[model samples]
Target chain A: MIAHAIFFYTFSIIAVVSAIMVTASKNTVHSVFFLILDFISISCLFIMIGAEFLGMIMLIVYVGAVAVLFLFVVMMLNVAQQKNQWFAGQQSSRHIPVGLIISTLIFFEIIIVIGGWKYKPEIFDINNSISQASISNTHSLGQILYTDYIHVFQISGMILLVAMVGAIVLTFRQRSGVKRQSYIKQISRERAEGVEVLEVQSNKGVKLDD
Target chain B: MEYLSAVFQEVYKILFLLVPVLVSVAMIVWLDRRVWAFVQKRQGPNVVGPFGLLQSLADALKYIFKEIIIPSSSNKVIFILAPIVTMTLALIAWAVIPFSATQVLADINVGILYLFAVSSLGVYGIIMGGWASNSKYPFLGAIRSAAQMVSYEVSIGVIIINVLLCVGSLNLNDIVIAQKNMWFVIPLFPMFVIFFISALAETNRPPFDLPEAEAELVAGYQTEYSGMMYAMFWLGEYANILLMCAMGAILFLGGWMSPIDVYPFTLVPGAIWLILKILLLFILFALVKAIVPRYRYDQLMRLGWKVFLPLSLTWVVLTASYLFYFNLLPVN
Candidate 1:
């Protein structure tokens, strides 16, 4: 229990600091790196808390895929040189109070959710079948995910599929006069079409263009 | 006192696993060079020791003694952190690799997922190093590598799912045990091929080594690194390759299981069987390096996306249906 607490605190602190650094860092690339660090630390916390399946998936999805895409975009855009104007821009100052209000509201919402869970523990007990100790984490999770929440799980997957198709549709383009390889046509070509048996073939070679 | 002893025991086990792995990395490097040389009819690295056994060792010493030149314009912190991250991540995935039924570090329920997650994170090292160097070639190499790895990982995931359907478990030991009757390579031959090819692409081996195409990218992300730093990248790369080979062995070749169940084969320990399997796969990897030509970037992307992805996905469906039809799926 002591070791768990020590690790929990360490990971949480790192996650929190890195979360702050995600926005506080000057360079956009650094911000993305910090974002990745935040994801990793949070995943570490998840793994430490015995939700190993979720933790590993979280690492795979967030740190591996999402953060990599974020870095790719940041690197491609060459935005690291741009000075952050969050604090200094007079023109953007008007939005600060609005941002502060929204952030505080969201913050309180998280606090209330955590506090509710803490105060009313029966809310979790209602679905306690999912956390049976007899089975492994992967088994239990799979059981619940495939059975109790099958529709929702599949619907979310379909939504992701639709989003991917939409993104491809949005970006895809066809350019004119582009020569594309037709594998079938190239492979099916016969020599008979190019080679003709003519009496004056040697002399007619000079008039091949005709 | 008990806690201290437990900690010491864990450390001892880690060292037991890691020291051999590091030594094997050196040996594998030498083997790779020799394989390449044998293909070209030359005696590769034979002067350092007996049959050039200490060539990699001498290279390590030279790297240790060389100067580490950090480019003045580079992002110093990330540049240094990149190779460390690479080497560390490469090594840590070995924690879950089962040499035998009893010889694994963490026999976690989600061991396969942990390996996948760790291996997926390996791209960050190259990306970070390339971007940190602030050079065009390294940056280009990093982007290519990032794209290549990510593209190949999808097919690898689908291929792994085919295996998981057969075993119905994620634990590496469980995977091996489930293969007692027959190896996965026999039934899931197509998926195995896709997995092997994707592993090659994932580890950035030739014909998929567009990231470090010497004629173009000039050592890729390692262009700016020098001394021990560059050596770390080299070590991490070979380690990653070995890890991929081990993964291939575990997933398709029945891991540490002997080829024959007879008395002679059974007399040999499981660890030896596993090592021999890994060495066999590594030799294949080296042979592919020598024989195959490098792929163009677009061709690599096309192969990963257009060909392997759909094929692996189809195989997953087919495997699931076949298992379901025959009631062969392992029930928890």
Candidate 2:
């Protein structure tokens, strides 16, 4: 119980700090750094929920690749921009009370809805039957993922396929001057004895430096 | 009250035991050098103590008193925090690894999963350290390291899936015990080899060590780190090598079990055998690094993505069939 509480509080604190930093930064590059922190905290929250695999995937895919792409792009674009331009209009201070009022109202509404509602704990008789109806709960997830969720997975796969194809199309422009290695040429060659008769002579006609 | 006090006493003893194990990683580096020195026909570190037993310690002391230079342009917080992140994450992975039946710090049900998670997080430190340095070489090295780590992690996961197919449990101890009659290396030998190789690459050891290749990227991702910070990365790398070897022992060599204890041949305790296997693996790793030239960056990527990834993917399917058809798994 204590561990769970700690996990929740830790992630909550991290999320809020990163979120605040995202807007508070005068420089856009610094904002992106905060954004990376936000993604990391969300991934940690996934781990606390027992989705270890998903948590790892999130870190490897989102943080490792996507956020990196963002940082690289942001760094490139933000290089010529002035830092003062970002914070000039945002820190007017007149909008603070209005923002606070709206946020507090939303917070109260969520608190009332969650705290005022209570559900009795009743044992579902279908727990064993439904569980047995499938294989291991984990295996059932995999099965459903392939069978029932097959179309959804397929569509997602297709979207990624399209994205990959688009990337190839966009990036495969010809470089007229530069040459790149051809894998076929490299793979088809074997080391041969072409060096036995080759003789190298210093240019005899060239004048030697005294 | 008595039991509570006893728990506190046990924790203290555990702390005392950890001191040696932690120090042993540094000693392994010295032993690793000596082994590789013999392999390569050279004399190893021999000045500090007999066989240079205290050489690594002496180096650590030297690094301690050295000045920690911070570049004026560097992000002070992340630059300082990055190495600590790497060291702590590396150490935390060791927490779930059992030295003996009762010696693990936290032998949770999902031990292997915990290891994978912690290792993935360790990359964050390298990335942040590289970026915070505000240097070109460090930046490029960090980017390359992050991408390479992720690529190999996929292959590692695939190889692990093959093992999980055979063992049918996630716990490290269970995986070890499942090899009572026969080690996984005997049946799933290919996966073991693949996992071991991927582990070396994951730890950024030689051939796969383009991230820190001095000739290419200067000192690579850690070009700007110095003193304790640089020491932390060095210690973390060695510590990670130990963790990988320990995991290999746990997953494939029957963790702490002597091969002959239940197999009608050997009589050594499982713990001693485990240590022996880990040290031997470290020596082998160092030997490979000592002799081989580092691979080019593109070549490393090609081997990881084009070669090991496909090999591991195929093994996953093959192992799954073997388990299901042979009735090894308890699941239907």
Candidate 3:
């Protein structure tokens, strides 16, 4: 229990600090790196808490794939040179108070929800307690994911498929001047298309231009 | 007192495992070079220690003595951190990899996923290196690597899911034990091929090593690195390759188990079999590097997205249906 508490605190602190750095960093590239760190630390926390499958998935999907995508775009666009203007702009002062108020409200709302949950823990599972001693985390997750939430799982997959198609359609382009290899045309080429028996009859008068 | 002893024991185990792993990295590097050289009809590193046994140690010493040059324009912190991240991730992934039924650093329940996750994160080192270098070529190389790894990861994920369907457990030991009857490669031959190919691409090995394509990118993300820093990348990369080979062994080749369960084969310990399998896989990797030509960029993308994606996805469906039909599906 002591070891668990120590690990939880360490990872949570790292996660929080890195999450802050993700937004607070000046360089966009640095921000992306911080984002990755945040994901990693949070995943570490998840693993420590026994949701090993979820932790690994979070690391794979978010830190590994998504954050790398963010880094790729940031490097490609060369946005690291952009001076952070969050505090520099004179007009930013007007919106600062508004931001503060909104953030505070959200913070209180979270605290209230946590407090209520702490007082009435049964609100979370009034009906079913899914976790069991016999099955491993992966096994139980698979059971619930593929059985009771099967429709939701399928729908989420369809959503991803649609999003993929939509992204392809949006970004895909065709250029007229570019020369591309046509495998079909190359494979289908025939000797009759270019060679002729009467070709040398009159080299100059063979109407080569035609 | 008991807690202190347990902690000490854990540390001892870690050190015990890590030293051999580090040494194996050296051997693998030497072996890879020798194998590649042999394929091309040449002798490789014959002078180091009577047939190049000490070549890796010599190289390590040279790297240690060399100067680490941090490019002035590069982000100093990240440039250093990148290689460390790569090496750390590579080493940590082994914590979950089972050498035998009993030998492992951590016998986690989600061992396969943990491996998958670590392998996927391998791209960050390249990306971070490329971006931190602040050079055009390295940046380009980093982007290519990032995209390549991400694309291959999708197909790899699908392939692993197909394997898990057969084993019914995510534990590496369980996967290997389940294969006692028959290796997964025999039944899931196509998926095995896809997984191997994907692993090659994931590790940025030859034919798919566009990130470091010397003809174009000029060493890719390692263009700016020097001395020990560069050596670290080399070590990390070979470590990753070995890890992938181990992964292949455990997932499909019955891991540490002998090929035939009878007689002489069974007399040998499981760890020896695992080592043999890894060596065989490494030789195959080297052979591919020597024999296969580098793929064109567009063709690589076409293979990953158009060809592999659909093929692996179809196999996943087929595997599931077959399992369900035969009532062979593992009930949790």
Candidate 4:
């Protein structure tokens, strides 16, 4: 219980700090980094909720891959570095108070919603399974995925498949003069049956070892 | 007062573990250097403190006192946070890793998943460090790392699933205990190899060290980092390597269990065996890094996506079959 509390408070602090920094930070890179921290906190929250699978997935997807991707894009663009290249107009500054007010209102609304809701965590304790229930979360998840959520699963899969196809299409660039590897032709290479060992004969008649 | 005491205790334990790791990192660095020296026919840091034991420490101290030069154009906040994230995540992953019986921070049921999560978080350091550098090479390096991590992560997951199907638990302790009779290495050799290789690629160790390949990327994502900032990356990297090797030992070599028998062998503690196994794997990794050349960018992607992914996925299917046929996995 103590461990849980420590983990909770630590991650919550991280989340709040990082979230504030994400908006307040001047540098876009800093903002993106704080976003990564926010994702981490959310992942910790998942773990605290006894959703280890979700936590792991969140880390693997968000921290390992997506956040990195964001950082890479940001770095490649060098938006922060481009600050000197462009003048900081008063346009954004003028809207700051209103943006802050709206954002804070929404944030407080979320806090209220969460604080108002209460449920017995023990009631949904995954460990408190009946003997007939699945062994682990993975087992239970797989069961639901294949049975109760089958259609939803299929639809999600389809969407991901489409996204994959779309990504391929977007990235595919055919330059007029560039050569591409012919995988089919390469795979079809046949070794001839009349494979005579070619004796390399220099004027001195040097035999190469097989 | 009680809470304060608990916190203090936690801090003390953390410090104790951390000091050893930091020292071990130094030792590993020294050992690896010496090995590389022999391989290359050159004297390594033998001149410093009788076989250069203090060299890594000296270098660390040197970095400690050096100036932290944040580039004017760079994001100071993220740049600073990047290395900390990297180092912190690496250290935290050690929490679930059991060295011996009853010697773990928290023996969580989902220890394996915790490992995955923490290791995954490690990429952020590289990404943030790169992005905050405000350099083109670093940016490209970060891009490569992101793509590589994602591609290899899928394979790693599949391999982990294969292990899980056989072990029937996500708990690291349970998995290790399952291997008490016979090491999982022999039966699950293929998965072991796949996992090890994926781990190598995941941690960005050579020949999978494309993210920081010097010839092309020019120190890659950490181009701008110098002094302790750079040292943090180095330390974080070596720590990750040890963590991976420790994990591999736990997963395959019966963890702290001696190879001999069911009855506890009085000859050596399991922790020693675990450490020795880890050391051996660490040496193998370091050796491979020293000898093997880095893979081309395209080749890396092809191998991770086209080859390793399919192989691991197929193994997952095979494992499922083996479990079903043998009725090993717990099922309704």
Top candidate, metric TM-score: 1
Best candidate, DockQ: 1
Instruction: List TM-scores for all candidates, in order.
Output: 0.95, 0.82, 0.93, 0.82
i-RMSD per candidate, Å: 0.5, 3.5, 0.8, 2.2
Cα lDDT tens digits, model 2, A1-210, are 765897889997998899999988766667887987888898888778755556656776777557766766664564435555444556657778999999999999987666555332233233433346434334545555787679999999999999999999999988788878777887877667322334557775444445
Candidate 3 second chain TM: 0.98
Per-candidate total of colliding backbone pairs:
0, 2, 0, 0
Query: Can you write out model 3's per-residue Cα lDDT over A16-116, one digit (the tens) per residue?
Result: 99889987887788888888888999889888877888899899889878887787777665463356455455766888799999999999999989988
lDDT of 2 at B209: 89
Tens digits of lDDT, candidate 2, B1-332: 87679779867866765676669878988988887788789899988988789999999999999999999998888889889988887787877887667766776666777787677666778887888898899988888888788888888878778778877667788788788888988888888888877887889998688888898899888899988789999888888889899888888888888867654445556668889989878877888888888887888788789999999898888877777788776454
lDDT of 4 by residue, B1-332 (tens): 99789889988877877788878988999988888787788888887797788999898989999998899988687789889989998899888888777877778878887888778777878877887787788878887887888788788778778778878778899888888677888988988888888889989999999999899999999889999999999999889888999889988888988878645664688778888999989888878878988888888888888888888888888878888998787544
The RMSD (Cα, Å) of candidate 1 is 2.5
DockQ of 2: 0.24
How would you class the docking of model 2? acceptable
Residue lDDT tens for model 4, A134-166: 365655666667987899999999999999999
Q: Compared with the true structure, what per-residue lDDT tens digits does model 1 show for residues B1-332?
A: 98889999999999999999999999999999999999989888899989999999999999999999999999999999999999999999999999888889988888889889999999999999999998999999999999999999989988988989999889999999988989989989988888889999999999999999999999899899999999999999999999999999999998989987889899899989999989999999999999999998887999999999999988889989999999988996
Better of 2 and 3 by TM-score: 3
lDDT of 1 at B304: 97
Q: Considering only N, C-alpha and C atoms within 3 Å, which residue pairs clash in candidate 1?
A: none
- Assess each prediction's global lDDT (C-alpha) against the native: 0.91, 0.79, 0.89, 0.82
What TM-score, to 2 decimals, does candidate 4 have? 0.82
Lowest summed lDDT over 10 consecutive residues: which window, candidate 1 chain B? B99-108
